[model samples]
Target: MKPNVLLIMVDQMRADCLSILDHPVVDTPNLDQLARDGVLFENAYSATPSCVPARASVLTGMSQASTGRVGYQDKVPWNYEHTLAGEFTNADYHTQAIGKMHVYPTRNLTGFHNVVLHDGYMHYSRFKHNTKTIESQEYTDDYLNWLRGKTGQADLIDLGLDCNSSTVTRPWHLAEELHPTNWVTTESIDFLRRRDPTKPFFLNMSYVRPHPPFDPPQVFYDMYKDLELPDPSFGGWAETEDTSGEGMSPVTAKGLVPKMRLKRAQAAYYALITHIDHQIGRFLNAMQEFGVYHNTVILFASDHGELLGDHNLFRKSLPYEGSAKVPFILADPGNNLGLKENSRVDKAVEMRDIMPTLLDAADIGIPDTVDGKSVMPLCKDGEDMPWREYIHGEHAFGEKSFHYITDGKEKYIWFSQNGEEQFFDLENDPQEMTNLLKVVDYQERIEKRRNQLVKELEGREEGYSDGKSLIAGRTPKPTLRFVFE
Candidate 1:
């Protein structure tokens, strides 16, 4: 029988947060257990590190350029023909998504048979900005509506939290049962109870915690609040960052804040992760109770990594490791398919590979248009497959707009706005604190990677590449959709 596929996604979770990854503070026991049971991709990344574009790549098995979402723009129409859920649905799987789809129209479904969405306080979908008014937050989001019903409050103001701001750390205003993380897990467990059992199922439990407000349940908050947490990392090249602005949230600005303030935020962030980890444990129990634990293929990943004050950067969208790399683990049912147990694959991989990997595992044909190659063969101990030498990634963020390439061993970055270049040897400088672009000994490899990036963006209008060398000082659009000439 084809395995029931459970694709679990978390938002803005760092790749290094797992105990299995030797994270000193945070503990994700559930995820660690999953890693021990399956293959973990040590170098998984998000090509575009914001929510929408990264999700677009995950859904369509396409590159950011191919998905036409090269930046973090809301309300762009999602018109992809062969989404991951759509393909599974076509193959007769019962497809359902619970929690944060983050797709446009808020209820697009994107080929899922049904979606219970909670996109988490999007400013664009709020009342005043919503022209139709019918698609406003209260009416559009199933979670918010449920939250309102649970609280018995007509209107709630983000539960005293900011979606984009990482400055504040607080306990959840509502009960833990009503929290969005628990809601997503509860809904998914209920899905197992209600799904058509004869046919295999495809369920996406997309959690939206650990992304913002740095809010978790108070118990979780207390769990890490008193620990001797390490201070935020500061890169040597980050001395000139702006650290003095009133409205500067973590995502919008780069700078160091008070040590206590940063530590509190990190505590809450880890607390949120542990909260979700516990909820995942609950989810697994429900799966076992429903008699589906032994016949499911469980895959877990995050949309992107939070900067968490790394290099004086807070939110994602930068090309730094803290913003781009994410945890990706696939746990097969007791290595039933000859997959390696408790093994790690260090080859470069990204969100695009998810669609093909899941489809291949279910014995389905991957669409020919997908740019991602399946990594399933790599999971089998002796199976050999052609693999990518490096994965290309980029995003548009005004002056921060950048492009780069990395093969897990080295990375090359080019700022499209100012033509500034940065190179890092991951083997030596995993922290990416020291820039190696000016080192004469590394110039040859630097130019090689630069040429590779040029080849990737050669024909673009941004004048990024001029065949022989890369150019700079070109203004970048916030959103770059594919255009047909």
Candidate 2:
């Protein structure tokens, strides 16, 4: 029988939060053990760092450009013919997804054998006047329906927390078992029990937490409330005197917040992560009890990272490491693929690589539709294996819309609305405290990176480049025109 595959994913989890990676405050013993037993990729990034577009790349094995989802947008139909789950089903694997499949037309399934979904709080789906009746959570989300059935409450908002708020912090108001994170683990373990024994299974266990609401169960919240957490890092370029009172808003993307509130939010966010870690431990133990522990191929990653007040920015979709980078671990505990154990790779990989990697591990054929190459070679052959030099990332954030290219050691940024440029030597300053754009010594290197960006955007509908240089003032769209084609 082919090896079973398990893809563990979390929403808005920072790449640097693992204790193995020396994250100062957060304790994730389960994740740390997962890393120890797997090959960890230190430079994995989301090419388009947001919930919707990032998930598109993960599901389809397509680059952001190929997916035509270069930015965050909701309500767009997921019209792809191939998906990670669909491909597994094609090979006769029993594929089931539990928790957070943020696709549109919420029940689309995207080719899963079955999906137990909880996309968390989406404004578009919850609106009273939503034109598409099928889009509402009441009509689709399995977790919400379960919560409503278990408790009399209609929604998570009963706790008085906004899903996307950055400044708000609170403990979950319900029983610990009812939290969405625990529900995902519980449903996943249940699937293991109920799965078909004759066929290899593909299980996607996705958790929606550490994203916002900043609410963890009370025990988790107490874990880091008074631990003297690290303050948020601010870049010199991002500091401002305006203090326009915008930061006071609960969900403002860019603004200075009170130090106490920010620390509390960080504590809550860490609490949620630790809570997820514990839940992951629970599921892993269940896997052992069910006798699938030895013959499984497990890959762990996140859709994207939260800025968590880095550079005074909250949420995702920015080119900064805190928002775009994510933790990636591929563990073949059975040595099914002869992979190097307890290793680390610094290659610049992205979410798009996931489908091909998992498919390759299962000895399944990678379809021609996949833009991402299987990263299995990197694990087997180490740095001697050939790989892409850098990854290009972009997001459509109005005036803040930007394009970036990085090779893990350095990054180059170009604003599409204006011709402004910024560069950071990530090797020397991982926090991106200083911009090196105007530095006399780094001018030649900066020019080379700029030319690379110009080459990357050479031919496109957006008219962002004219071959020789980047064109300014071009409007960026969340979805490229080819999406409709």
Candidate 3:
């Protein structure tokens, strides 16, 4: 059963930010509808909670610890082995990657034959001389260049201020009509119009809006202003005393002052998500337009979630649900596995399972070597997966390092260097407002999980899920039943 694959990944987006998640301040009707007609995973988790590494884990079907890509600035070292796209290609599927993969070089395209990256005009922050794309001028070329060419916009190139050192004086709408979604959507649609259908394609596309700069053009930016943004996780601020890393604060903790205007930042973030949701509408429409709607599988998700001031953090890299819980939507047009729309799965799912799941969905063999289990059963109801009781993740950004494991009821976090420990009984405190690392009684549970973590890490290595046994191929093919209504 040959079918097409369209995987949509958004950067730094939170699972709870959507209206479907009962987030009152934002409107993402497009995503809302998509979730309705798709299986929503309520507890999908990141393999590791950083951008580059998290994305790499999803693509490679391995843990970030094994890939050695613990840094945001680190390249997805080719040594990790075959990526999902590469696997599909090897299996004779035509693969493409458009939008933001956030792979190093920003637009490396990695293995996908067709690559289009619409960046946030991300420059080489750590490296000065490298051009992100093969085409040097393209980074700031399209609409950004056109906007810069405009009279009023031209004078405000840098806003004559340092974005890192900016203050929250007023609600500032990021200036520009050419938002990342606009450009990304245009490129995606163009790719769709020219796509060849006979080959059965696999497009690993991504959207770069909700990632950073918390900037959106006018209409979108205004869409959420004064929308009664949710109260700031309630001094989600002071709770960071237990976390490790830099100041990681937005207040006057340093000479930088406060970087985000809480209200304004929320408004901008909501707007960016809305804009992204609209683009999703466009892609969904494209599926129907191309007559591939019933023969393709659509996956929409984020690599990891952003904190957005939860615990006073801006991005992912923390273990709180705000940072680790990512969107997991699997919409099978054929409902091959009998997955129903708007159905929510309560089981704990790690991102590592995505590779094997996709392989299984496509009738390929599941690799036993991969540490993640396939969830196609729970997705369609074959066998119970025994849902993971504890999900583990780590953050190795720069010199900062931390490890965490959570089982929905309890969470344990530890920093290696100074050996700081933090624990929370999430069932009692979902907000994780309290720390119990050094608490008694919980010691046994913490030690058990720590031992489990060590065993899991020690088993890590290179290769596909079931590489050797793939001599016979393991991705399972399910009995399918398609329904139009």
Candidate 4:
């Protein structure tokens, strides 16, 4: 029998936040069970932390900059030809996507042949609002008009935070009962129940909550309300002595995150992650009840990590481990046959490896255009292809941006547009408390990684630099500069 694929994606999830990862504060019994029953990577990093770029990387198996997508709120270029969606479709697999595709303008590939998307929840395109009476149409309207009946607020949504965050609110969380993962899972199970059954299917169950606004149900929030969140592990968000170019309020003095609210925010963030786990558990259980668990290959991961006060940052893309790393788990029950269960792999992996791995798992020929190497062997056994020597990720904002190449022990980052370089030794300073680019002892290592980074990105359009710019890459192409502006 052909294998089925279930790709479960959550937004803003961290690599170390899992119970299997031994995170003390967050509760993830289901995920822990998954880790025990499958293959979990202790170190996995995203190509980019922002929504669109990371999603694009996962879908296309290429760097975001190479895709020419540098910011959120951008669309796939008209010329991106090798997306995994098309490949799966070509493989004769019935492809479908539910929840936050996060791709832009709805016309976005839908990737799958079938799609039921959350227009408002993920990339709700309504223009920002002011006074008058405030407005929201995407999420709630989709829920009321198309999704739920007029009275469809029946279940899901209704987290402790104001329901105003939902589809109807200015920013819109919808109702706590309409919580994203729960809604996403519900749609996925419904699809599975109604599937044709004559063919294998590939489904993308994506969630955008637990990304921000940290809104969880009253009960979930209660679970972590009193738990004291660890303080910022890396001193704080310090700025260069000259703050003229980037002068902003220190993290502690932000809009609503003053002293009194930080505690609640932290708790809410943890609760939201637990909320994602709960819904994922429900979905996994449903697969078992339907008896498809053993036949399906389940891949669970997140677009990127969030900063619940880590390094005084909020969302993603800072080169900090907190926002750069994500959780990854792959389970193929029957194929495991006699393979060990409840095991883990400690090798370093990059999110870019996902596309190749998934297609390889499905027995689809990975197109030569894909820049990632398959890590499937690592799953079958811890030893694979000597593991990767280094992985690359980038975040580009206009002409200026940052790129990183890490050997797992040390990381070298270059802020290209500004010509600034940074080096951090994770093996020694886990929190990345200090920049060692100029440290006499680490200078050689820094130069080596820097050269490696340039070499890796060489002959690649977006990766071009003084040494490699003249060589042909993807294209000199137009910039989606409007999004960054």
What is the lDDT of every predicted structure here?
A: 0.86, 0.91, 0.64, 0.67
Scanning candidate 1 in windows of ten residues, the lowest lDDT window is: 243-252
- What residue runs in model 1 are displaced by over 4 Å at the alpha carbon? 127-130, 154-158, 240-243, 246-252, 382-385, 481-485
Tell me the tens digit of each residue's lDDT in model 1 across 139-163.
7889888877877773435556578
Clashing pairs in 1: none
Candidate closest to the true structure, highest TM-score: 2
**Model 2 TM-score?**
0.98
The weakest ten consecutive residues by lDDT in model 2 span 239-248
| lDDT at 445, model 1 | 95
Model 2 spans with C-alpha error above 4 angstroms: none
| 72: Cα error in model 1, Å | 0.9
In the range 202-221, model 4's lDDT, one tens digit per residue, is 88887766765456777788
Q: Which residue pairs of candidate 3 clash?
A: 364-475, 365-474, 365-475, 366-474, 366-475, 367-465, 367-466, 368-466, 369-465
Model 2 shows how many backbone clashes? Answer: 0
Q: After superposition, how far is residue 221 of candidate 4 from its true place, in Å?
A: 0.4
Q: Candidate 4: list runs displaced more than 4 Å.
A: 76-79, 119-124, 128-176, 240-257, 335-340, 398-400, 457-464, 468-485
Instruction: Judging by lDDT against the true structure, name the best candidate.
Output: 2
Ranking by TM-score: 2, 1, 4, 3
